[model samples]
Target: MSGSPPRRGSALAADRAEPRAVRTRERVVRALFDALAAAPLEELTVARLCRDAGVHRVTFYGHWPDIRTLAADVFAEEVDRLARVPEDVISEAAGPAELAAAYERALRDQLREILERRDVYRTLFASGSDAGFRRRLLAAQQERAEAAVTQLARAGAEVPGRASAYPAAFIAGGVVAAFEAWAVGGATGVEAAARAITAQLPGWWPR
Candidate 1:
């Protein structure tokens, strides 16, 4: 015999609730960014966030444990958005030198964007910022770097007789640290920061 029919009423209620949940999330994110524009994350409180978002404290707690968690979610989204390089530029590289140049260009572009929002990032990524946020941010960047390096290795990029993970980790860790330092130093000189990063890549890398 067939199983009993699904609960249509419950399913319908969930379906309707999803959009409202999404809207609430959007409002919270908007409020967080707006607040950050005027004040640092350290100064932001759950009460103020809920007030600005027009959400209740219970509603805010329903989504995140505290302000730092919500801030992490917001900054994570920004990091991912700024970290993505133009795929077409990478794909169209005619040789290793071109590919390296493309990578530098992409890095500079990303840095420029970050420099535009320097105050916000400087506060969020500073030494005094949330440790969990920094860890998650570094992990996300490392994961992306690992995947890219792995793909390059599969496509004939050199790795100095070691596995791709070695270079991936080195580059990811160095770049993240370099950028974090740059942010902590008042987020100046995008060109200098980008150059410092590109200079660290080993000769065996795609360059």
Candidate 2:
């Protein structure tokens, strides 16, 4: 049986509301980035953010519980893009040399970003107040690691007998630890750190 058609007024109102909500979120994100340029994440308050966003406190709370959650939501996408492995790097058709070069380029890109944002990285790692953002960073890296491992296995790489999640988590955790150490200690340059981190990957990993 066919369902009754929807009310035109209600459908139009719903469509309008969605765009308005998107605009509100975009404004908030812009305000947050502007605030961060002048001050650290921990220093911004809901009242100030709402004021800068030109949004009511109730509207802000409706979108995010707090500023930390908003920051995590915003920065997580950047982390995902930085950490994601290229498809060719895990494709079976790619030779070892090609895979190795592509993988190294991707790793170096992530490391360079870390170097560029070392101050923000250090703040996220060191401050308890920024734990949500740190967790978001770890989660994003873990997702990419899992994708790479899964794709590599499908491409004939020998994965461990245990669940794939275990190895992926280990790899992601190690990368996060390496970043934290580098940000906090400034022990090695980006190239050295990238090489060191890549060296620790499992033998079965592509390159």
- List lDDT for all candidates, in order: 0.69, 0.71
lDDT of 2 by residue, 124-202 (tens): 6665544476777788888877876666566666778536478889888988787777778866577888888889887
TM per prediction: 0.77, 0.75
lDDT of 1 at 96: 58
Angstrom error at residue 160, model 1: 3.0
Over 1-207, each residue of candidate 1 has an lDDT whose tens digit, in order, gives: 779553322112224257876787788889998997898777989899889999887767666767776766667567756666577766775755666666577678767756776666666676344435677677777776776675565556776644646766777788777767766676478787887788787787676
